[model samples]
Target: MKDRLLERLPGTRTATDEVRGAAAPVGLVPRVSGFYQEWITEMKKVTWPGRKDTLSSTAVVIVVVLIIVAFLGLVDFALGRITQSILSF
Candidate 1:
């Protein structure tokens, strides 16, 4: 199977075929165009998240981050006050 593949594509391994000891053409143009072709084909197979799921995930991330930021801010303010009190003569 790999032998047949080697004959069909006359170029350096497409970042994957090289592992199977396939022949890779040492040409820069072929390599770049090959990468984009593979990328487009793979992207077509991807099942992207739906709009509602994406927005819900974004909101959840924002809320969690805001909670963490508020907690850190309170901790910083409390530490600043404690340090100021200790330094007072």
Candidate 2:
């Protein structure tokens, strides 16, 4: 995998070579820039969610969280009441 990735970068050495006492990192700048270049290329291919889809997904998440919070609040109140009743004896 490292070799294949290095092949894509055209001119940089694998970081393994640097660890193995290869000379100065002569290709650091090119390597970093190439990584970002690949990032932009891949990002351009993404199917980003539209505004409506994003809003609907966020609403679902909020509703689920609220339901869970309410459920947990009831459970906590029940436990507190049980504990108080036991201690008051």
Q: How well does each candidate superpose onto the true structure, as a TM-score?
A: 0.72, 0.65
> Per-residue alpha-carbon lDDT of model 2 for 1-89, expressed as tens digits?
97687667956767676799835435989778878998999999999999999999999999999999999999999999999999999
- Which regions in candidate 1 have their CA more than 4 angstroms from the true location? 1-20
- Candidate 2: global Cα-lDDT? 0.89
lDDT of 1 by residue, 13-83 (tens): 57565666857658999889989999999999999999999999999999999999999999999999999
Could you tally the backbone clashes for each prediction? 3, 0
Q: How far off is residue 82 in model 2, in Å?
A: 1.1
**Pairs of residues at least 3 apart in sequence or in different chains that clash in candidate 1:** 11-25, 12-24, 12-25
